[model samples]
Target: MPVTTELILARHGEAHCNVAGIVGGEATCTGLTDQGHAQVRRLAVRLDQEHTTAPMSALYTSPRRRTVDTAAHLADQLNLETRVEPALRGLDHGEADGRPWTAIKRRFGGRPQQYPHRPIAAGAETWNAFISRCRAVLRRILDKHEGERVLIAAHGETIEASFALFLPLPLDDTELAGQITGHSCLTRWQRHRNTFGHDVWMLAGHNDTNHLRSPMEVIT
Candidate 1:
């Protein structure tokens, strides 16, 4: 029998760049804010209460500080070790890393008409490259962890791109760019073979923040 794989995708909590309104990539703006810590702890508490006896198979996090911090709270509660995944990191903003949004426009001749197709920074990823990385991550998870439950801590755009890999929607790059994945919110997906033996990825949850009990629950 082909078993089902459950994928839990959690967005990292708020970070310095979120408050500063600047672009981020690499190790820039890595630490989670105080509220971010609270958010992740709330999520951990919820998971602890619900899954005290059942620990997930693996915990993977983006190699950035914010995501690492967020994953730590959950991993500690569940007694699981974490692995850093570069494919799970956020989009690289390149030249826009430290510039304010307004300054970014002035410097880059205006924010690329579409973040997916345009690079706000000369060294940043094109939308296609971003999706490709997301696909790679998904493929790895499917191939390696079938029938298991796995948790991932990643970025907003990364989550959106991952969704794009499996969702059969009319969402354009504009729609994908417009999504706001709240801090510490959790999204879930399941993978199983269909009646035709075709592999399918189905969404089970999206942006679930009910675990949050603080102002951090406010979607940014």
Candidate 2:
């Protein structure tokens, strides 16, 4: 009997760059803002409650300040250690790091998602390249923890890439098709072996932000 593998993906909370409308690459990312921390804390509480039903075997985070900070809250809440995965990081903004989106659009001609092969700027990762990297890392993680529940704290783009990998969504139309993931939102997928002995993945959940709803959820 093949057991199911549960993979839960969590988007990082809002950062200063998010509010500032600037690219938040590793070079420029400081960490989560105060409201960001509060958001992650709410998520942490929810994950803690869910842990009783489905205990997480492992926790991973993208190698960015915002993601790491988000994972830190979950780690502390669940008493789990986190493994930083560089491949799980968001698209490389390269020269656009810390730069305003308007400036980047003027310099790079458009957003990185507009072209699959063309990078947003010199040294940046192309949209296609990012999807490939995310798929590879997701495969490695799934294989490493075949039957266990694993959690990942990463960026919204990383979550979008996951959808591209599992759902086989068109790379160009993923975000353009109005598939924007929310901050501190949770998405889940399950891998199971079918009767034909083939592995199939199911989208268990997407953009679940029940944790954010307190007395009243503040729209960011």
lDDT of 2 by residue, 1-220 (tens): 3548988999999898899999999899988999899899889888877688778999999999999999999999888999999999999988888899888877766777766778888788888889899988998998999889999998888787888888887656323643668889999988878889988888878999888885433322
- Per-prediction TM-score: 0.84, 0.90
TM-score of 1: 0.84
**Candidate 2 residue-wise lDDT at 82:** 95
Per-residue lDDT over 1-220 for candidate 1, one digit per residue giving the tens place of the 0 to 100 score: 2537878888998888788877656746668889888888888777667665655899999888888888988888778899998778777767667667778767656544354566767787766677777777877976798678888888877677666777743334542444658999988887778788887778778888988753333221
CA displacement after TM-score superposition, residue 218 of candidate 1 (Å): 18
Top model number, lDDT: 2
Off by over 4 Å in 1: 1-3, 105-115, 168-178, 192-199, 214-220
User: What is the alpha-carbon lDDT of model 1 when measured against the actual structure?
Assistant: 0.75
RMSD value for candidate 2: 3.4
Candidate 2 regions with alpha-carbon error over 4 angstroms = 1-3, 170-178, 193-198, 215-220
lDDT of the candidates, in the order given: 0.75, 0.86
